[model samples]
Each structure stands twice: as C-alpha cells, then as structure tokens.
Target: MQDGTVERMPRQDDAIRNLTMVVYILQIVNLFGVPGAIVGVIINYVKRDEARDTLWDSHFSWQIRTFWWALLGAAISYPLIILFGLGFLTGALVWCWYVYRIVRGFLAFNDGKPLPR
Candidate 1:
C-alpha cells in the first residue's frame, strides 16, 4: 500500500463477469429473438476489452448470432412442418443445432483459449 494510493479493480474482468451473467440470464428467457440477441451483442461490445484474454466474448458473440438464426429457422420450419405434415423433425433439428452452439461456446470459453476472430 502506498500513500494516497487506492487499489483499483480490473475493469476487464468485471466486464467479463457481467457479460457472462447477462448471456446466461437471456438463455432462460426462451424467446431467442433479435431483441435478446441485440442485448448479447451489446454486452459483448461493452466487454470487448477482455475479449482477447477471455474467449467467452467470442463465444458469446457466436451464441447470439446462432440464437437469432435458430429463431428464424424455427419460425420458418414449424409452420411448414404442420401444414405439410413433415412431423417435428425440422423443429427438432433447429433446436438441437441451437443447443449445440451454446454448449460448444461454453466449452470453448471454459477452455481458456484465445478468442476466435
């Protein structure tokens, strides 16, 4: 401790923590629309300072993008399946892909690798 010196917390780490929490919270909302994805994008942008150190930022970005796409896929596929009598396969595939993206993102984040692009 030095005179007139106050220890400062790491801003990057704080941003990472906040962004990660936001992503998890949004996951539970289940709407998975552009609005939610936009929040995720905002979180990532706010936390970009830590993106290099924490791969989670990249993963979060990917998750947000994938979520939006998955939602679109569901919107297009569900009605077609019902009207054409294709069963639930299309919807199920979209859901499975969404889950895969989220899980893969989590794994990459936890692996401590450098952020992708």
Candidate 2:
C-alpha cells in the first residue's frame, strides 16, 4: 500500500472549463438580440490560444464556427424575409440549429469530452 495521495486538476484546467461555460451561457443569452454572442466569440478568439493543443481547442473552434455560421444564416434569412417571407421559417430553423449546437457543446464540455473537428 503506497502512501495516500489525491491528484487534482490543475488550476488552468479549471479556468478553461469555466470560460467555456461562460461562452455557452452567452450564446444562450444571444436569443435576446443582444451583443452577448459577439462578446462570447471575441472571448473565444482571444483566449483560444490558451487552449491550443488541448481538448478545449476543439470547443473553441466549435464555438467560433457556431457564431459565424449562425450569423451567415441570419444574413441570408433577412434577404429571404423581404423577398418571399420564407425567412421566418428559415430563421426559426437557424435558431433551432444554434440552440442545438450550444446544448451539444455544453454537454460535451460538461462531460470533459471534445467536440468533433
């Protein structure tokens, strides 16, 4: 029987995990047509280097992609809205997709798993 010792996660790991959680929350708060999402993406870009070569890097990429893609989807939806009124449907679909991404990322992050590249 070796001497008892309990290994614990490093402080940086905790900080990265907490930061990811904050980004997810910000994305959710984005539903209110605010700048929260923009702020979150900015954080991801600025701090992503801290996560490089680690599991958290995938999440950083995932969040950034989610933000840009959702923005593109919204941009397209606006034009469609004016042209054919189909944008409402498309917008709703985009919202669903965005929610799905955020939820999926949050779940994976919570489980200490990485998102697909």
Candidate 3:
C-alpha cells in the first residue's frame, strides 16, 4: 500500500454486462447453426481476456465446449437429416439450450451469485 494509490476490485456488474452482450450476439449467430459456431469461436478467441472472470470462467468454458459440440452436431446432422429428421431438430435444440445457459450463467455471475452445479 502507498499514499494516493488504490487497489481496484473486479466489478461483477461489468463482467455480467459484457457477458450479456456476448450472449445476445451469440444468440443471433446461433440461428445459423454451424456457421454460428465458427463465428463464436472466432469471437471468443478475439475476446478471450474480456470474457474471463473468476465467477464466469465456467460459463466461458462451457461456451467454447458448446461451440465445438454444435459444430460437430451440425456437421453430423446435415448428411443424416434426410434419413433422420430428428437429428437436425435435436442439434438445433441443443444449440438453443447452450445459448440459454450462457445467458443464465451471465446473469448469475453478474448478481454475485453462486452457479448451480
């Protein structure tokens, strides 16, 4: 400690706000499925530091994992959609849930609340 020097604390609200923006942007991309996954990876890589926070690390990690899963799901579902229409629907639903989780986690993190395990 020094005179005229102040330590800065991490702002939970700011982290949540930034994450909320990321989730909304991702939701828009998610509509396009695999293409959205690619965009998400790019966005996440570019904003990795901003996306990082003590309370939100799990959320960010899950976002990356879900992106990969959606990417794989899209690739697998495309060729099987004809034989198994349900594959496409299932992938879309999973992707939607992934986005929903991100939003929920962001809100929770912003409120300085513990995440549900």
Which prediction has the highest lDDT against the true structure?
A: 2
Tens digits of per-residue lDDT for model 2 on 10-73? 7886787788889999999998877799999999998998888778889999999999999999
RMSD of 1: 4.5
Using TM-score as the measure, name the better of candidate 1 and candidate 3.
1
Clashes of 1: 0
C-alpha TM-score for every candidate? 0.63, 0.88, 0.55
The alpha-carbon lDDT assigned to residue 107 of candidate 2 equals 94
> What are the lDDT scores of the predictions, listed in order?
0.65, 0.91, 0.62
Question: Model 2 compared with the native: what TM-score?
Answer: 0.88
Model 3, span 1-117: residue lDDT tens? 578888888776566556545654674566754355456566656666665655555555556666677667767777777777877787677667766765775566567564543
lDDT of 2: 0.91
| Model 1 steric clash pairs | none
* lDDT by residue (tens digit), candidate 1, 1-117: 568889887776666755775774565355454356556656666666666556465666675577668778878888978798553788878878877766666666566543454
